[model samples]
Target: MAREGARPAYDPAGHDTALRATLQELRTGRWMSMRRLLTETTAWWQWTRRTQVLATAAAGTDVVRTWLEEEPHSVPATVMHARVCVERALRAHREGHPHTLDLWHEAWRASHTATRAAPPDPVPWVCLMALARLDRERQWAEHRVAPPGPMLPPGPWGLLAEADKRDPYNREAHHRMLQFLYEHGTSGRLAEAAGYAHWAADTAPPGSALHLLPLYVRVERYRRSGGRDAALDLHWVAEDATREAQRALYAWFEQTFTAERSLLDLNHVAHALWGALQFTDATRLFEALGPYWTPQPWAYRTPDQGDTAQAVEIFLQARARCRPA
Candidate 1:
């Protein structure tokens, strides 16, 4: 919610200039507190308060740097005010929208007029990821820049077909790419999916669950492209792939495993081959999947006790949002 801030009481011609100076005074180098800055701009106390709130929120050094460099035109009361906006972006990035990284980077660049220096080494993961994204965006633009002259050299993963690439953070993107290849039954896409699976498998930590979905993706792809033999080979790999070899044999492959076949398996066999289903089978399996994956009536043992009902409702809401459009 935006805090209420007073607009100008009079048509002061210097309002714009005054606002700029006020922000400078509250900046990092100026070191004046919000309260002190507000004292001098008494007529615009509400505006001062609004800036102070925002600045306090954007307090991190990286955020401050970004605010300083990127959003030069932002009418912050001080550097602190800009910092608040940066903090808001950071919070939003971690929660889901990785796109905020671009916004912050842009803001940081806007603040400073000088040619930007390379950011200091040992950058945080978020910053590193942002830079990586920027590099990709730059490479993308370069190809279009020359209008079909000589093509630019491909970035490491850029040459890979869409089906073959994966983002470490976007699990759904990986799944969707695999799903597309499966539904289409494109041999080229299958090979690409395999490449994607291998890439994800290699990059993922040992026994990481992220590998399971991709592995299953490969399994499904192989069976669809080849036959039972390919499916069997995938099962063999899945069995050997797990850190807990003993548990692998009977680990409720679908609901309980990384490539869980169905959230709610109708039978023991369905549960047993949880990681083996492909697109055609997935729909057949969804009737069972919905009960467990969604907030169906049967799963609730208690509707009101221990706040379990509320939690279940929340889970259901999330599942609803994840539902296929």
Candidate 2:
């Protein structure tokens, strides 16, 4: 499928070749390749890549279903099936499809089966947590359930715990937990989200991509405040929050600037820095991204304005602002 919008003037194709290759391996029921793919992607905090691969694969679930039926014990096939089902269910709910619930239920079943099939893998647990979060969001939005109270439902937490047990520093798992907390925690409690981000960054080993967690929180804050330029302005460039977030970005740049560095993280930090008017730092990150825009942070810059053109405009403007004198 052709991705909409003009490709950025730099490295387009989203640098997703690796992701496509990994999905191809999954299609062939290559369990070892699947495991290696997950391990490497997760270690590099390539959540977007992992998600894109899974969602794309889910678009062809019939083939995945056949693979699973042929090799019931194939961990790769099982987890891919679970991921594809969950993604489809989430997409259905987002699109207001009538069969959202049925798809969700099937996702739950597939996730459970994957969890049982590969007792040591964390991906299934991550899928379960994602399902729980999506379900809660759907219920609250559609059924008029009370906003999430002081305590989160235990199911998501338990699933996160299991995922953490299997992969202590799994960025994807931690991100889901963070999202759950942000969604279910008290309204207007941005500090709590910042606290979680801080703790996660501090606990992660140096060079770990977990340092990007604070930037994630910042993006969410911008998003919640209506994604206006005024929202970005309110958070001053010289503010302590901006300084701390920049520190985290610098840490990642220093210790984690490998060839395999995640483009998502690069784009996020660049966006945050641009919002803060740290043009030089933002420029450096943008250069590293080299035209591979992820359509987030940028897409969310303008509330109700999330088309490809806007994202491209945002990227071009940021790049221009950071150009060397």
Candidate 3:
């Protein structure tokens, strides 16, 4: 059964299809394929990480744990196990399920094990950062921490530093660190997050995915403040704060635009532009995306609404506005 004007749960685009096949390979114990898929290229690790997270969220933690048990020293499997644990913890928190702290600790232990197994792999360290964020949130909620400081202890920053040592340009590592700092930084200010985003963008090499950092911060800001209408506030758009965000977004789009690699970023950029009333620019992204919609930026826009419905509505609206007949 299908709802009217609703997008499917998962759009079968080329990348999505590839990810599904890769997950199948992993589930089938195709270690060689998994290694080649994860390690043979740059930025491919992001897809691996994303795939594991999605698979774990959709399936369950036991599948990934079984994969880990099958390959004790497998870096990919271990990292994925850690990621699955972290995702489960986050999901439990969102759903108000019990034993979230226990899940967080499990994620921490798994990430630590993965880090030990593959000292040079940044993926495990990225998982540590995620665990650290969860732990920090737990501490804040429990202790009611005072202002001017995060409840984070020393370990997470060390993990991020090690990740940087392993891969100075690790996009996921940087993004995770940015999220950690943005939420827990002493000032708790969007300006601080923007500062980190701009610095990362400036330091990154040309055509680097780090250019989307500011857009990430902007999306976070929008989510924290409110949904679509709040994001579309004239004052927020006209303020000096968004000037750099817009510049960074357009720069990323101009320099490193691709429908293939970072479709998630494309979705974010489209959402940002649409909120800013840049219908034409948003339309280009919608065209590039075609029917393959990532339910993130749209989902965030309307938290109470179904993700597929929200995504479909936004996509159709952008298409109509951008391609008026």
Candidate 4:
């Protein structure tokens, strides 16, 4: 409920009030609030989400390191230390940093230690999977595991399974796996990734966030294309596209509580529904989103891939299109 005019300013905290506050404190070099927040979070999904966000904030700071220094045996601190390390590695990979190999090894070691320290938690395994992207050459045998089906290429399936054993249909785990596929794909179409996405959504529980997997893959596929082709405009409203949007709508949005929904997932579904021209169905998602919005999905609606200003404008235009009856 930021008061900055009509449009809700983008909130990076993404609907988690506690996470927002804790991120602020961590930015100022305080780890106490983060400790308390994660301590009280018992759900796997929320724990993963909070850790991901907190790790991003802690990546450039010593907050997680400091916390670990004070509480060497703390499982939460260990998990967070792993999370920050993985975040750093992922960021380094994206930037093509020269020391990516060193960071990747450091993150891998930290993540393995976290897996040992917190066996029941999925975040550590997720950490391991997240860094699988840094292994573009698939040097490790874990990165070369055979896929369960014919569609998937060799990947760290064992790491994905370990995380899944802890939390079935974990959103981030699948996302991390998808990231690996995208980075390691041999073709421009990401056929393996598309097949993997559909396979995931096929097995997901109705209420789980994994329902949004195919939607993300669609966005990724769309982005991987030149993204500006007018003919490709039909990509969103095609039979498969609309069906995917509706499947996510019914499977995820309708089955979950408003409070528990991932903000980015909400944005994805709303963007999909709107793009598919299902304005009436999209209306509810827009209302559920309130003022907050993520920029990428909407940015894809524009010709430019990462155009925030145009993205916001398109988001507002779409919101306007799907208002109350």
Candidate 5:
């Protein structure tokens, strides 16, 4: 049987009819086979030659589009295609290759335009990062302007901070609120983050990372001064967040570490989780650090007090000490 979205396999007997129907379909934007329409995997060098030719010939036209649709997950293939197109365009621009930049720019605009027209539902954060960088580069190449940072949604981190001062320990509320804060914070929603933080602090853990996060160093002074309530409050805040937020951090951490390679090398996540008293997730991460340990490195700031390495160590230590249940 013929494939689902393909034209009937060409047959000499029906050549005239097929030709007439295909031509008519083309005029209406109906492709013979969307899957076979643009196969970029024929061979890398050969593919580039064709892409370059198509781009050069179709400069400033919607020749290679289909990718901007946000219906599908942000697959690596889409990212790679965008990168290849951008690289070729930039190279052409730099080398003064005839029509190279124009073709590349055309392709870039087509894809990005498509992205904007129907921005991915989840907004394809990573791929959008790539697009953002590409736009910044292209702009600098022509207009010399840096792209602005991503726009965020509102959150309540500030309010929560104030509330935490009035009542320094409230793990359950903190966990729930922090969950909403972090989730919404991704969209640059500060008001939402602040509201969640306030709610979280309203009834947060007794002593956890949530409380110690903003006061890692200063709180240490309180801990050393026999301020048991303050110290324990800090402890509960960290631990509670870790345990509750384990899945989110776990997904990210597991993406990086493995059983054979304890995150002791980086330690930040582990430490943060440990500070939150999230020994269970930490232990699981330590034990499953096998092939899951991605050789690719990742680094990011956390809570301002400790780095990734500290986070890892703190968690590893916790994992080591926890009695198996």
Candidate 6:
């Protein structure tokens, strides 16, 4: 961990200096750094994460498009082309852009192209799963497919399965499905999403990150509840809340490497531990987080949403309370 009492800064890249540097390069319309980084990224988890992050930057510019124009046959460029298209489509949908459908179709084509270009990679299939969120009407039969079990609503299970075939229990794949569930189910207190999260957590291995999925659902519930709650304190210390926090800490955080941990996952687990009054346990997560904090689960705790300064205040207070001996 960084020096004690150091203030944490929000970084989307979060501990991946290579990704931070690549983000800068992409901002300047350079793709070689991205190319080299992807070329060296052999792990599936890292590959998908890096591609997803890079695409967020690439979608706002012609970086990926220019890279593709220069190297039509490059598989990395091809995959990134799909990533950018998917990113653009998601953004367009979120912003209610005029050409959302066109971008979605374009992204669909790109995702398929990337799947063929990199057959064993799960990211392309994950792209398809993410797009399922756009199909609110379930125009595609696959999007309305039956769930694998009870209490789980119908969704693009096949697309998720395709990702699972390549990378079983892939983190982003499940999260994409979770996003679809949030949109598919209800406006307040997503019971189905919580069910799916618990289901995923129950089936995952002890060391898998899926153990933390339910925590995200809990945060979402709090977020959608207008960000202010008189019973919020009790909500965090509820028996179920404490159980999920301990489950994730033992099953995922303790078994996983610091490098394998996501910043948001770390923040959530720590926040959960703190909320549940497990200060000593929370301290370990805070230590692992070091100087990089993701303003999430913390921001939702306050009435004001999206205020970084307020989020940091709550985060620091929690950190101070749980300071390790």
Alpha-carbon lDDT, every model = 0.35, 0.68, 0.62, 0.88, 0.35, 0.90
Query: Candidate 3's residue-wise lDDT over 68-176, tens digit each?
Result: 6777777777777777777887678668788987887888787788788877777777776666656555363322332223433222456656777887767777777
Compare candidates 3 and 6 on TM-score and give the better one.
Answer: 6
lDDT by residue for model 2 over 226-300, one digit each (tens)?
766663666646586577558757677777754546666778888778877788777778767764767777877
User: How many clashing residue pairs are found in candidate 2?
Assistant: 0
Cα TM-score of candidate 1: 0.25
Residues 1-325 of candidate 6: C-alpha lDDT, one tens digit per residue: 7576788987778889898999998899999999999999998888988998899878889989998999999999999999999999999999999999999999999999999999999999999998999988788998989999988888999999999999888999999999999988864579889999999999999788899999999889888886666777688999999999999999999898877788989999999999999999999999899889988989987778788889988999999998853
Every model's TM-score: 0.25, 0.79, 0.76, 0.96, 0.29, 0.96
Native-to-model Cα distance after best TM-score fit, residue 174 in candidate 3, in Å? 2.5
Question: Model 2, poorest ten-residue lDDT window?
Answer: 142-151
Flag regions of model 1 displaced more than 4 Å: 1-168, 177-189, 206-208, 222-325
TM-score result, candidate 2: 0.79
In candidate 5, residue 110 scores what lDDT?
A: 42
Assess candidate 6 and give its lDDT: 0.90
Candidate 1, number of clashes: 21
In candidate 5, stretches whose alpha carbon ends up further than 4 angstroms from where it belongs are 1-78, 83-126, 129-243, 246-273, 278-281, 291-319, 322-325
Residue-wise C-alpha lDDT for candidate 1, range 168-201, written one tens digit per residue: 3233333433443343333554564555555554
Please count the clashing residue pairs in each candidate, in the order shown.
21, 0, 0, 0, 62, 0
Q: Where is model 6 more than 4 Å wrong at Cα? A: 186-188
